[model samples]
Target: MKLYIKYMVSLRCKMLVKEELTKLGLGYASLNLGMVETMGEITHEKRVQLKNNLLKSGLELLDDKKSILIEKIKNVVVEMIHHTDEIPKINYSGYLSEKLGYDYTYLSNTFSEVKGITIQHYIIKHKIERVKELLLYDELNLTEIAYKLHYSSSAHLSNQFKKVTGLTPSYFKKLKEKRTQNLENL
Candidate 1:
């Protein structure tokens, strides 16, 4: 049985889900962000228990197809931005279409209808957020961050960053540093 879960975005969330499944004595074939493949069929009573347990830990079991597809889209984007080092070579439309076995047009329309934002815009938002995280880490320079996130150039990254955040990457980095310094001073 394949089950879809909501709010399963982080590695810590995955660990918690795994622990819960183990605690329930359910054997899972695989557990990915927002999805789990069970080795055996789950009884209704057990499913209800699993749902209750996951809810206690801030996760929700999804049953609706649209919600499941939306979660799949989110999981794909989240994995691309937060978990992977290499961006896919293809454009996001093609990537998502191929991954989800739907036409790009259909997926785009569904995403926009459901999310109230274009998928491209959602991707840009995630990319900018990822840039913020990398900036806070202080491990990669602007140029490297640009390349890592598949931005065309450092200037391109800077332009988008400024457009989205009203601050340059350098300014954001400086703000992060200042916050760190103040926290340490306390």
Candidate 2:
């Protein structure tokens, strides 16, 4: 049996799920972001218990096809941006289509209908959040950050950052530094 889970976005979440499954004596064949394959069919009572256990840890079991698909889309993008070292060279629509085995048009329509935002806009939002994370690290320069995130140029990145955040990356970095200094002073 396969199960889809919401908010299972990080490695720590996977660990928590595995721990819960072990405690329940459920054997799982494999686990992936937003998905798990069990070694055997689960009983309704056990499923209920599992659901309640997962809820305590802030995860939800999903049975709806549309919700599962949406969570798969989100997991793919989040894994690429936050967990991986390099962004793929292909365009996002094509990438998503190929990765998810659906027509790009269908995927776009479903994502827009369900998410209330275009898939492109969702990617941009995730990219901006990733940029904010890298900026906070203070490890990579703007040019490097742009390249790592697959932006065409630092100028493009700066423009987009300013558009989304209403502040330049440099200003963001300075604010982080000031906040760190304040924390240290305490």
Candidate 3:
């Protein structure tokens, strides 16, 4: 059985899902961002209980196939940006197509139809969020951040950052000492 979960974007979320399954005496083959896999089918009662528990912790159980597919797309992108040590050198469309086993155009169209935003826009949004995270950590300079996130140059990064955030990266870094906006808000 495979379970699709919402908001399971981070490593802590994976740990939490694993712990919850353990507490429920459920044996999972693996747990990853937005999903858990088990060897056997889940009972209706067990599914309900799992859904309720996940909901309590700000997660959602996706039963619909379309919803699951969308969540899978989100999970792949989020994991690549947030959890992985490095971004792939290949094109994102090709990478996503190979990873998801779907035509890039189909997936992008579905995502845009359901999410009301283009897949590329979503990637940019997530990358910007990652940039914000790196900036807040204060371990890397602007050029390094730009390079890590695959921006062409510091100037390009700054332009996009300002376009999306209404402020320069330097200004954003200074404001990070005060408060940061939620990723969804950006």
Candidate 4:
């Protein structure tokens, strides 16, 4: 059985899911961001227990097929933006379509319908969040950050960052104070 989860966005989240599965005496074949694949089918009671446990930790086990697909799309975008070392050169629509094996239009429409926001908007929001992280670490300059995030140029990155954050990258970096938001909030 496979389970899709919301707010399972980090390595720590994967670990938590694995731990919970172990506690439930369930063996999982794999636990990736936003999902878990088990070796055997789970009963309704187990599913209910798992859902309640996950909810306690600020995660939700997705049951609807459409919701699962939407979570998959979100996971892909989150992983590509926050976990990968390099960004791809291809357009996001094409890349996502190829990755998910669905038409870009269908994916976009479904994502928007379920998420109440465009996928592109979600990507932009995540990119801005990443930029904030990079700036906080003070590891890269604007130009380097732009390149790392696959922006056309530093100006483009700055513009989007400002638009979403209400502060330019330089100003944000200068603040030098942490202002982290929960992934679920984003």
Best by TM-score: 2
Q: What TM-score fits each model?
A: 0.95, 0.95, 0.91, 0.92
Clashing pairs in 2: none
Model 3: runs farther than 4 Å from truth? 177-186
Q: Which residue pairs clash in candidate 1?
A: none
**What C-alpha lDDT values do all the predictions have?**
0.93, 0.93, 0.88, 0.91
- What candidate 4 gets wrong by more than 4 Å, as runs, is 177-186
C-alpha displacement of 142 in model 4, angstroms?
0.5
On residues 10-128, what C-alpha lDDT tens digit does candidate 4 reach at each position?
99899889989999999988889999999999999998999999999999999888998898999999999999987778999999999889999999999999889999999999999
Task: For candidate 3, write residues 92-133 as lDDT tens digits.
Answer: 898899899999999999999899998898998999999999
Candidate 3 TM-score versus the reference: 0.91
Q: RMSD for all candidates, in order, please.
A: 1.2, 1.1, 4.8, 5.3
Order of quality (TM-score):
2, 1, 4, 3
Which of the predicted structures, 1 or 4, would earn the higher lDDT when compared with the native?
Answer: 1
